[model samples]
Target: MKTVISLLFIFMVIVGCNSTKNVVTTDTVSKISDTVKIANEELEYEVIIIDPGFSSWIAGRALPRGYYSEAYLENKNQFYVAEWNNRVAQPMQYDSNLYLFRIDYDLTIRYGYEVNYLIYNYFIYFQNRYNQRLGGFVPKQ
Candidate 1:
């Protein structure tokens, strides 16, 4: 219950191969404070999502809670995490910025409904926003 989840999301603006500068636009700045924390005390797991616009996006675009079963979310999350980790490993092939960190999601762990829901939606948001596909089916709300 006391476990602290700390995840950093550094979104860089890639102008060109030569540019190393990180740009923070007005939209980015506004969304900077939009962080969503999902924690299950009984399960002792926590997920913190600091991606810009995710808070608002989830509120407006994501499907309502319980729309999909926890099992479904877990199944989708397992597949998405696998693909995400694969991309993170092969940075040369995938955009390193998009796949910066490898997600540590264990299938054996029962992360409950809220944890799975947030993680699943974040994956959908990520895929849609970045134009990346983690699975065969198109990422949807």
Candidate 2:
């Protein structure tokens, strides 16, 4: 009887601990999602503010095959996040889920000026590195 009582107490304690841990984990995940959403919104707003015609250009473009890999885009995005923070004087976070690569792919396809891969990368690298200032100056075709 004593053994049964001790076992029951231990089980209850374990279950209680697990439930609390789960709650904490869930809360953390929710907060993270919220932060991501806000950051994505801010990113979108900044991009539009800097390049008002970008959306229209993107709508008319198609993504090219082998033009960019997921891994490469992700690395660029991470670098962009760091550069953006330096430009904006705030730590702007980013996630791969933000669809930045998709936007880039579309923009690459819609680029009006004749450009090869090398020229295109230089243009985009400067645009992003400068937080769209270079992009705004470049006349879109």
lDDT of 2 by residue, 1-141 (tens): 432232221100001111111111111111121011111221121111112222233334424435666445444444543443344343254322211221222221221121122223433533543345421343232
Per-model TM-score, in order, reads 0.73, 0.30
| Every candidate's lDDT | 0.64, 0.28
Pairs with steric clashes in candidate 2: none
Backbone atom clashes (below 3 Å) for every candidate: 0, 0
Provide the RMSD of all predictions against the true structure, rounded to 1 decimal. Answer: 13.5, 21.8
Question: After superposing candidate 1, which stretches have Cα over 4 Å from the reference?
Answer: 1-7, 10-32, 40-44
Give one digit per residue, the lDDT tens place, for model 1 in 19-138: 222331121112236676554443444456777678889889999999999779988988888888898899899877667776767565555676677778888888787677887886
> How well does candidate 1 match the true structure in TM-score terms?
0.73
